[model samples]
Target: MDIFSNLWLGASTAFMPMNLFYGFIGCLLGTAIGVLPGLGPTATIAMLLPITFGLPPESALIMLAGIFYGAQYGGSTTAILINLPGESSSVVTAIDGYQMARNGRAGAALATAALGSFFAGTVATILLAVAAPPLAAVALNFGPAEYFSLMVLGLVASVALASGSLLKAFAMIVFGLILGTVGTDVESGTPRYVFDIPELYDGLNFVAVSMGIFGICEILRNLEGEHERSVGVKRVTGLMLTRQDIKRIIAPVLRGTALGSFLGILPGGGAMLASFASYAMEKRISPNRAEFGKGAIEGVAAPESANNAGAQTSFIPMLTLGIPGNPVMALMVGAMIIQGITPGPNVISDEPALFWGMIVSMWSGNLMLVILNLPLIGLWVKMLTVPYHLLFPAIIGFCCIGAYSINNSVFDVFVMAGFSVIGFALSKMRFEPAPLLLGFILGPMLEENLRRAMLISQGDPSIFVRSPLSLSLLIFAVVVLALVLSPSISRKREEAFTE
Candidate 1:
């Protein structure tokens, strides 16, 4: 009953003319970013963060939230149309989606992706509304020790989730953590790793590093093979799915939604995990599993739906626990903090309108994305015809602008360029950047909580095991780590890598 009343209030708030307009604008911009290679919701939102300062908190958040999830909708368009993935989550989609396009089933692929995403998003949003409160209550009991253990678990899970060698992933994570320490120490007021650069005192800007690594590095990679690239052009025959397509997709979409909704609530789970897990699940369960990488409709439907559902439900952890599951969610947390809104359990009880309003806006935004993306599919496909020479320069320009705008520092531009080179080098070495980014984002928080726990225990490390919750979390982390490093698990991991 109370949930219904809160939802009604949320509907009322979200339906306001101003909020609705912002939601539409957000969806539009998000789709544009997603369609364009190298520009993601995180970069887009970071660029627009300053503009949101003038708007009311609810309206600002609604629009920002819209952009986050709407990107998932637009990302699949590029994945299907071209072999290029607009987002990391769309990588799996591109495997079968591009195959479908090559097989002259682009229309069917697009339709399945759109319809599956809509269905999954709707179900996930409902699950979020129902599950967030209980999750928040659980989080409210976390002391410093528990939080430290949770952070360790998150970091370990993230490293295990990386696509490459576990040792390489751990190395990248350690590098990121070391890089995260290059600023003024919060407790001692001592500067470390600054090397006497004034800008270094503030640490590396997340925007600069993220944009440099993702955006600029992508541009450089694309440019290297520009001459060899053939623009994937396919005739648009139809846009609607056939009855057979629908029959094949319904089960995958439902399964994806269930999997994504649950996984997305975990501390380190987000769209990428959702998509990857969905693909693995579909392959295991599908009758025609061998067809998975060969334009299977289930392949297009399952991961597409799962990524969207995960994107929507990821907000639950960010909003209710003040713990971001990914860099994109971390940026949302930054935006919330900028608006003077502290995200935690009390947010629901204290700021019901903001909480519920954001929830309602997610559904509204999903509806808007479906409507907007259907017609814009042709336009997005046409964008692929734009030459790489022209697009690469524009992308670099945006990367520079985004980095500079983060702190209004020209130094950030230099930082971006430096990281771009480093990212390219890392890519050449076969190291994945995503886990490193995750480590950089979580490292400081983990350290802070660990230090606080130690202080509370008067430097007694045994305090970590004294608390039951903390002990359990630590045990889980250790067990997972042990399993990941075991000989049997290593053999399977090597097989996956070889594949």
Candidate 2:
């Protein structure tokens, strides 16, 4: 089959010494951050994005992908050990996992999390390989009108699924779009909002902006409420699972993988949402539901599987249509642009090795995580004892160096600092920053496509409606908005998020 040959090609590239090393490094750093409660993958990746500009596309992306999913593995460790979830997706894991630990089944709970995540990640990677080509093929048919409509659909879906007030999400999106307009106009070759600054001509550097908002801003928030955690976990043993334990986890793992794979393709639906949804579903339908909050192994298996699967499959839309489903993926899109490779359908045909290589690297990365994480559990636990006051300064220093390296200019450092204040202010106002990042990333593309469609139609807006595909996409966006607005669905959404 064509898939076999493609995978063989991917394997060759993924197995290279340098790529493997980077993947290992990424997994290591991801686990370290995941063990530290305040640092999420989004901030970690944004902080490291500028450094990747020098790497080969395959190596850089493979490493980033490893960091993303490896966090899922690491988060479960702290959840089971200390009742503190290293990542948001692991929040539900902490409930039952800590209970299991308290009951002295810490090793079993951890093994379940590790094994479940590996199985889910493997299945999701296979699904990605089988699914991405066709999706990219379909996307290849999109013209400017269709592309514009698709972007609208993505933005609308993002808003519909974003946590917090819809009005605030909408406002952030508009503000991001406005920020995207700061650079020179592509068509007219005129500066719009440069304010006569030479560095502003290229607009705000995405890496700087992202680092400011995610990396530095997170540090600021964490410092405000900083407190040292005292970890007192007992030594873990009994790593092997019984036959009954295996049987109990089988169905939950399968269900979690399926649900996560599907939801991961949706805009704004990533590991955090998938894990929560899966845990909720299992609590309702699981045969051992009565034991849910009292150290249920099913609770450990299902959500860990779902979160890992969701993390992997969330790459679908990003790789196929060049549309990022979440903030992490948006940062990835920015990375691709920095590497001089456009993220889109053409990637498959134009750069098969890089694309397939990244795909294959994910499977290898999963294997590495399983091998690396189990033995490193003690090391990770030790890492958690490092106080925030000691760790945060190093992070801040790295961010500053990365920002300045963008153009070898001090201006970017200033930009990052400025945006950190803005991001902090936005956080104080309770506005979610995910949609804003998505809007900033998609804004220019949306504007370009809209203008091209208008040019083709000689300014006739009917061009969008004349194409059935475009019309359908627009209609779907409207329906999504309508569904989110309905009272019953709104109540359900609130409940789902609250849980």
Which candidate leads the pack in lDDT? 2
The local lDDT score (0 to 100) that residue 322 gets in candidate 1 is: 75
Candidate 1 residue runs with Cα over 4 Å from true position: 40-60, 98-104, 195-197, 227-235, 288-294, 487-499
Q: What TM-scores do the predictions have?
A: 0.89, 0.99
Worst-scoring 10-residue span by lDDT in model 2: 226-235
lDDT of 2 by residue, 409-477 (tens): 999999999999999999999988788899999888999999999999999999999999999999999
The candidate maximizing TM-score is: 2
lDDT of 1 by residue, 1-499 (tens): 9789988988998999999999999988887777776677876775666567779999998988888887887788888887887877888898899899888898888888888888888888788789888877897889889888877776777666445677887888788778888899888989989999999998887667877777787777876765633557556657788888888888888999888887777655778778888888898998868998999999999999999988888888788877677767777766776689876677888888989888888888888888887777777776656665776677677767767766788999998899889988999998877666767766677788889999999999998999999999889888878987899986765553333
Per-prediction backbone clash count: 0, 0
Instruction: List the lowest-lDDT window of 10 residues for candidate 1.
Output: 490-499
RMSD of 1: 3.0
lDDT of 1: 0.80
RMSD, every candidate, angstroms: 3.0, 1.0
